[model samples]
Target: MSTTELSLAGSQPGGLGRYNRQAADLHYVTSRVMVYLLAFTAVSVIGFPLFWMVICSFKTSTELYQFPPAFLPHDWTLTNYRDLFIQTNFPIYFVNSLVVAGGATLLSLVVGGLGAYSLSRFKFAGMRTVSMLTLLCYMLPEVLLVIPLYLFVVDLGMADTLISLIIANTAFTLPLTMWFMRSYFNAIPASLEESAMIDGCSRFQAMRKVTLPLALPGLVSVGVFSFNHAWNEFLFALVFTSSETKKVLSLGLATWIGQDNIYSWGMLLAGAVLVTIPVVLFYLLVQRRLVVGLSEGGVKGE
Candidate 1:
C-alpha cells in the first residue's frame, strides 16, 4: 500500500489517466483490426466458390477443360448460356422451380401465418406441447422424412406431379414459417390490434388492418426463407418426380453431370449462375426488412 501510494503520488494525476486511455485506445484498435481480418477471411472463403463458378461459367469449353485451368477465362464466351437455353429444357425447369417454390411460399405463409397468430395470441391446454412438436418436426432432417412422405404421396397417387412437389415443400416449410411468424407476432404489441377492435372493428378486420401491416417485415423474411428453401430443395424433387418435364431446377442441373462424355460442364456452370440470380434479387429487395424482423423477433420472443 505504501509502495503503491508512493508510486501514485510520484505520477501526475493526469499522466496515469492519459496512459490508461492510450492503452485502451490501442486495445480497441487491435480488436477492430482483428475483427476486420476475420471478416475478410470468412468472406473470401465463403465467396470463392461462387466467384469461381461465375468465372468458369464465362469460360469456353476448351478453357474449362484445360489441364492447367486458368483463373481468368482464356476465351470468354456466352455460348454456354446460349446452349443452355437452346439445347436444354432449362426454361421449363426454371418455370417448374418458380411455380413450386412460389406456391409453397404462398401456401406456407397463409397457413403458417394463421397458425402462428393463433399460437402467439391464444392460450390453451397442450399449446406448449404443440409448439414443441412443431419445432421438433422442423429440426428433423428432410432425408429422414422423405421415405414416409414418398409413400404417403404414392398412396394418394399424386406422385410425379407439380402438385406433389408443392404439397411436399409446403409441409416442410410450414413449420419454420409458423415458428418464425410466431416469434414475430409475439414481438408485436397486442394493443395495436386491440385498439382497432375497440374502434368497432371485428377481430379479423383489426388483424387485417393493423397487425398485418406491422408484420410485413416478418412476412417478407419468412417468404424469402420459404422461397429459398423450396428453390434449393433437391431430394424431394429428385425422388418424387422421375419424369423429365416435371423436373425442377435442381434435378435439371444434375443432368449436366453425365456418366460418359455426354454432359456439358460449362452449361452446368451457366445454369448455376442462372439459378442464383433470382434468389439474390429476392434477398436484396427485402434484406433491410429481413434484418429488422429477425433482430426484433429474436429479442422479443425470449
Candidate 2:
C-alpha cells in the first residue's frame, strides 16, 4: 500500500476499536440516564410533601378524613384559610414570629458580622480557640442548651416575651453566622477595605461601605438561615414562652394537635402554608444575590 493509504488505515479504528468506542458511548449514555433519574427522584421526594400540604389546605374537613385519601382535593374551599385568620390567633402568632425572626436575624448579622470581620482582619490572642469554640457551640444540640437558656431568660425576667426568643435565636445562630461570614470575609481581600480607609474613610466606614457591600451575599445567606431557624423553632418557643399571646406560629400550630385527635387538619395545613410563605418569599427575593455570591466565592477560591 502507498504510504498515504498506510497512514490513513493506521489512523482509522479497527473492529475492536470501534466496539470499544461504542461501549464508551453506551456507558456515557447510561450514566446520564442514571443521573437524570436520581435528580428527578430527589426532587420528587423533597417536593411532594410540600405539594400535598398546599393541596390538602384547600380540602374540606370531611374530605380530609376520608379513607384512601385523594391526592387532590375534591371540594375546594377557602374555609381553612378563613378560619385560620378569623377564628384562630394565627395573625397574632404570625406577627410574633415575624418580629422574633426579624430581630434575631438583624442581631445575628450585626454581632456576627463584626466578630467575623475581626477574626478575618485582625490578629488577636485566642482567636483560633474562639473560632473552634464557636463551631463547637454550633455543633451542640439545641435540646442540651434549652434548659440553660430558659433559666438565663427567667433570671433576666424576660421569659414569655418576644425579646427573649429573639435573644435566644440570636445566640444559637450567631456562631454559625460568624463561622460562615468569617469564611466569606476571608475570601474577600482586606486590601479593598484598606484602600477605602486610605482614601479618608474610617475603619468602620470602610467596613460599612466596602466590606459589607462585597459581603452582601454572605449576610443574606446568614440572615435567611437565622430567620428560618427562629421562625421554625418549636423547642425554644415551647420552653421559654407560656402565655397564649406570646406564642409564635410554630407554638401556635402545635396547639391544634389535640390529645386524641387533630383539631382541624385543613386549618393546620393552612397555617403551615402561611408560616412557610415568608421564608420562601425571602429566599426567592435573595436568590439572585446568593447565586452571584457563590459564583464569586468559587472564582476567588480558584
Clashing pairs in 2: none
Q: Candidate 2: what lDDT?
A: 0.85
**In order, how many clashes per candidate?**
0, 0
lDDT of 2 by residue, 181-286 (tens): 8888998999998999889999989989999899987888878877888888889899999798999999988877772164588888998898888989988877
lDDT of 1 by residue, 1-302 (tens): 56655665577586785676577679989999999999999999999998999999999899988887899997789999999899889999999999999999999999999999999999999988887777777778889989999999899998999999998898778987888888789989999989989999999999999999998878888899889999999999988998889999999888667731655788888999999999999999887776665554334344
Per-model CA lDDT versus the true structure: 0.87, 0.85
* Cα TM-score of candidate 2: 0.83
Give RMSD to native, each candidate. Answer: 4.6, 4.8
Query: Could you tell me how far off, in angstroms, the CA of residue 191 lies in candidate 1 after the best superposition?
Result: 1.2
